[model samples]
Target: MCREPYPGRVTAPVFVLTPETVEPAGAAATAVAGDRLVLTGPEAHHAVAVRRLHPGERVDLVDGAGLRLVCEVTETAADGGRRERLAVRVVERVEEPQAGLQLVLVQALAKGGRDEQAVETATEVGADLVVPWMADRCVSVWRGVKAARGRQRWGAAAREAAKQARRARIPEVAELLTTAELAGWVRRVNDAGGLVLVLHEEATVPIGGVALPDTASSEAIDHPADEPRGGGKGPQDPVTIAVVVGPEGGISAAEVGALEQAGARTVRLGPHVLRTASAGPVALAVLAQRVGLWG
Candidate 1:
């Protein structure tokens, strides 16, 4: 299906698109908004032919860059028998408020596609960015062409998962990174006043006890950004928390030491150890709730 959740029971089915699909005044958002949009290509065909959605029905469209259009379907027909047409009349254009803190998942490469699974679940849980890590204990290796293909697959997975969750902002899928590179990311996030956490079975600190950005108010972040990646940094230095999860064999003591020296705090998710594919998502869910982004 091309559509997914819309918060409440009566909300329209939501679809995600790239910003390039709708540019200029066509996708231009405004406070008092009413516009016309045609959703063609796969999105239109899936809705029209597959789901059997029709005109006069309500739907929601998002560019995945923060613009969401609550619309009423107007047309569905064969365009010269060459294409399927699904049109909508905009009811309102709403921009979802950016989360005060950005969530990042740094998942280690694991065999049997478990790394991919980790990233997919993390995106659905509200991760703003996903990083594929080449850890010391990783069983899977992404070398040369494999690295490019791996990253591309991760990006596609994150997009599909985000759309399924009906998120307006799709989480970024970064290139496969080595432990040294992961350390650089830690420095970057910390410079921007965010915390980097490593989930270890041996850590003394618990996940819930970690420091978090204020959810009570939009208090400005005190940290200054030395290098800003996306919308996560500003005056608030927007907390860019990164949850690091190791591979099936688990993180090595040496790798743990390296990360801790680079500003990452070793933290435990629970008493029992989780699978490599399960650890990052579990930590992300816990942190999102601690920061009050979830109930």
Candidate 2:
């Protein structure tokens, strides 16, 4: 009943809805042909009033859970509250396939919200998850209540960025972690048959040739029950690409050693040192292509 995003129109407009608005996650939300999908509230207002999406135009609704409902605007009308809305007819529904390679970025917190900016770009570039790493060289600090707020801020940025990029899935933003915790993540990724790469300016190895784990993930995609990721061994698990980016002051030698010791491959992004805000996303773009996700 559902398929992937329409193969032809990559530029089709996409809008996000609350999890409760989608079925399986919530109640009575799945759509079918002839179903009237009343897109209202702020999202509809943005479409009808600001973006001027007229009747008969096509649009897509994604629930961030891989469900993409493709619909056509049937008519334009106003809600009881006087805001404009579009009455859409469900043409088809599709479930987007999960990314072949899970790209996770561990970014060291930087001053002036540079870290948050990095998450925004990373989400746009298809990072499945992100972690805020509080490294020794980081100028910013997150403690107690501040730590919770920081995580919330990063999550919000990811949501907005994913929406702007018209992605069907939004990347996750994890808790702020210490150096020791980062090492633990590397070990977990390694054990799960994933690749963990650290971005170090001084490293001699380039990210280009750092061979990823294996091609097992491509086969796992066809059989969801086969445990495509996590707590799996050999060809059954999906490969994870975790990139660690340091702050403005750069990573401490000790921190780098800790991560490397935990099975992270230290690779340089390029000849020039990149800003803490730009490094992780740039590395992800390179890895995405290398892994054939961009193809």
**Most TM-score-accurate candidate:** 2
Clashes of 2: 0
Inter-residue clash pairs, candidate 2: none
Residue-level error in angstroms, candidate 1, position 119: 1.6
lDDT of 1 by residue, 1-295 (tens): 0112345623467676544444333454452356777777666666677767888898778766656787888887665453666778878776665555678999898898888898889988889788889998777899999999999989878877877777767777777889998887787777666788999888888988877744455432333223344334356545577889988888888888888888889998999989988889989889877776665
Candidate number with greatest lDDT? 2
Q: Which ten residues in a row have the lowest lDDT in candidate 2?
A: 219-228
On the 0 to 100 scale, the lDDT of residue 204 in model 1 is 86
Model 1: weakest 10-residue lDDT segment is 1-10
Angstrom error of the Cα, residue 58, model 2: value is 1.4
Q: How close is candidate 2 to the true structure, as a TM-score?
A: 0.86
Superposed model 1: Cα runs more than 4 Å off: 1-11, 19-32, 78-82, 213-236
Clashing pairs in 1: 221-236
